[model samples]
Target: MKVIVVFGVFFFFSIAAVMAQPANRQVFWRDLQSRYEADSNRVVRVYLDKFGYFYPVNAIPIDKQLFLFPAREHNVNASTISSANLYAYFHANQTAQNALLNYYQVSQTGNFDRDYKKVEEQELRQISRQVHRLVENLQAKNIIFLVHGFNVTDPVSRYVFFEHSVSQKGYDTKIKPLYIEVYWDGLTSVSGTDLLAIWKHAQNNTRWVSLALRDLMRHLDDRLPFTIVTHSLGASVATGALFNTSSKWLADGNTHDVDSIASSIPAPVDVPIKLGMIVPAIPGGLTFVDFNHRSPDITTVANNIVGIAIGYNPKDYATSKAFFSTSFGATTLGCDHENELRNVSLALRGCGYSLAQVQQMIYPVQFTTPNIALGLQDHDFQKYMEDDVDFSLFLAKLFNE
Candidate 1:
């Protein structure tokens, strides 16, 4: 009887120990990097710094999951000193150049011995070369820019959402225009700050975001037309930059139509822009508001774009509360009633635009309940695009036209 009892105890202990062992699952970051690498694609990460110049952000080999933004200083690590932000870096590695950097052995294994300044310099040259090559190719007539919203950590989600939207519209990478996904620090935790702080933080983030977009537009080939697909806060980023009259970003004598805006934007002369805002989390009718009577009205911004589309769902309760309520104390365009736009003339006039011309340039899209399937209450990228026939058809016509 004693021996049998002892055997039973021993069996249980062994089983518990076996269960405690960690599983050998593949790291998600590694898998994401490998997927792009397999296709011979190189990622070029563009990050705008406080100085207003966009810099190249890189990932260390020790863990490519974290990307270190280099600054102007050097500190020795692993027998090597370099200037970079080692402590403050993103854990997700969404930057596109992961594979190529690995191939070049940009960093030493388990040793931060490489000169980051040199690495950054080399990476910048590589990115410029890649852009020049693409411009010379002349195969793609247009480029798609993907902008994500706030409070996101997973890098793969952004890529998947981007690819899905582009693919759904019958645009294949092999035969269609090239695409670039802009990943910024959109992650915000509500536990730490009040609503005012959060709003200010978003303003700071978009400050650089606007500069990055302006820089990107300048970099692209002048003849190629480009379209933007932005979700949530991305709408704010686009509208702020396009309509902002006093931003120092445009203070470098690039003004066109000076009287229209005290600081008029240098509208793209060679390339056209088509803007799309999906589940945008901005205040209702904020885009159409006239900012300081002297400034070129939001309609002026609308005039610059070839087309604009706003996607909203009445059932998107998340935006209704988190975005609309918090920002304006009421439902926003993202959560407004379907017939909100029924009075087209009234809506167009509000933004200070003529219905005859701006009617087709800007429009709103309403999504049904069945199409909203991305979050707890459905307020994400997937909900806005997936299986939504109307949205897809809209894109087809915009791009086709």
Candidate 2:
């Protein structure tokens, strides 16, 4: 009897130990949760469901990283499971579940039209209040909004990057970090058609972003200055939000929209905002045959903004291949051009502009220390924070302090 009891006890212990082992999926979730919990300004909640996980809007902490997973529900199969899996399982509602099912049946089937619209409105209100509070607290400094790029479905990645960028550089004094994660829950497939559909969704998501920004600007104090940093596809969306859509205020020469613009501008000469386009996959005038077919309207905004910084890399396989296929009908290795921008110097070089030109147009600053080489192979921007490097200097340069 004693031996049997001991065996039962050992069996339970073994089972518990096995469950505790961290796998790729669980580790991802843990990292994501940690990032959210670290944020001082916001409270983040994460949920697990059949579709993987869902986070509250802008609830991700600014110093973590994770992969993107598409919401798939229809045509349920092995492909759907693998293609739509994001991080770990998160909670979902019947409506989201049904939408996921429909999305699985077709390439662009999910219509969060009604549900997401409501969510967007509610989130906008919440974000507006948050921005109001932030501006109230950090009255002395300028505000900079940072948006992340593609393949980042996890909110933690945004949080991790924001925290690291601000803390390493000690820009907390001069620039208050306002990180905004514009998520469309992009699909995870190498298929060109799927990728295009994802891009379209990203474009659609821009409306929510515009609403959020406009609302935030409305609440902010008139004295604060604002700047925006957009990476990868986020750059395209940001530019579209500002330039593609004609604002009623801009058309009527009303100063309502100008408030957001004027806050960022040192002197009003038609341009009222500063935009930093970092390691964007597609620039305004450039055309790639296979990747980005046309230059987005973002270029027009860049020209109009107070300052615009285009970061690129010649050796960046992603950018090179995008241009090669789109422009020359050749296919090259697939690499993420957004990640290539971390190599500050290479990013500047590939930006299709001279360093002096960038400085003259935006700000005369360079990211030094540990050198840009440290980030050369790092495709994940969040990794920059975890790894020991002198990234603080780069943060300092960003604030010009």
All candidates: CA RMSD in angstroms? 16.2, 16.3
Residue 183, candidate 2: Cα error in Å is 4.0
221-265 per-residue lDDT for model 1 (tens digits): 434676777787766556554445332223323222222222333
Query: Residues 1-401, candidate 2, lDDT per residue (tens digit)?
Result: 11111222232233231122111221133344454555536422322211212333333331122222333333333223222222221112443434433433322324433333343334435555665675566553555666565545574555556656676556665565554433433223344344443443333233234433443444343435556666555564455444423231233233223233223312211325566644454433221111110123223223434455554334443334434523321112112233332333343345354566445544322211122342433334443333334334334334562
Per-model TM-score, in order, reads 0.60, 0.48
TM-score of 2: 0.48
- Count clashes in each candidate, considering only residues at least 3 apart in sequence or on different chains: 5, 28
lDDT of each: 0.47, 0.38
Predicted model with the maximum TM-score: 1
> Which residue pairs clash in candidate 1?
43-96, 43-97, 73-83, 75-81, 76-81
